[model samples]
Target: MNDKPAAPAFDRHMLEALVCPVTHATLSYDAERQELISHAAGLAFPIRAGIPIMLVDEARQIKADD
Candidate 1:
């Protein structure tokens, strides 16, 4: 059996339905970093392979300019 779970496929269109868990603001996708940025909240939600990790506890705190 595989030790790690496979990443789920994230549909780009689905981004429209996603909002920042903290601020309830829209998110912008960073293709290079594979993350969803919530500038309002100053947080970066990581996108693993394709699936986005939306949990606030798992998100990385980011600088306003980042």
Candidate 2:
């Protein structure tokens, strides 16, 4: 499954200015999944093509332990 080309790196610096839309809390980067994890919001905002999709509707619903 590791056949695809590596994706563009997400700018880690942007994390400083970005926050979870739902909770207005800090988000953590999940590099492996290319997502921004919002623990407070219980969602994982996906990063596609090096861009973070902060919209709640586009986020994945996550379990507490996830």
Each candidate's lDDT (Cα)?
A: 0.89, 0.96
TM-score of 1: 0.81
Please provide, for model 2 over 1-66, each residue's C-alpha lDDT reduced to its tens digit, 9 standing for 90 to 100.
Answer: 669987788999999999999999999999999999999989999999999999999999999999
Give the TM-scores of the predictions, in the order they appear: 0.81, 0.88
lDDT of 2: 0.96
Q: What is the lDDT of candidate 1?
A: 0.89
lDDT of 1 by residue, 1-66 (tens): 768985666688978999999989999988778899999999999988788999999999999888
The residue pairs found clashing in candidate 1 are: none
lDDT value, residue 41 of candidate 1: 97
lDDT: worst 10-residue window of model 1: 1-10
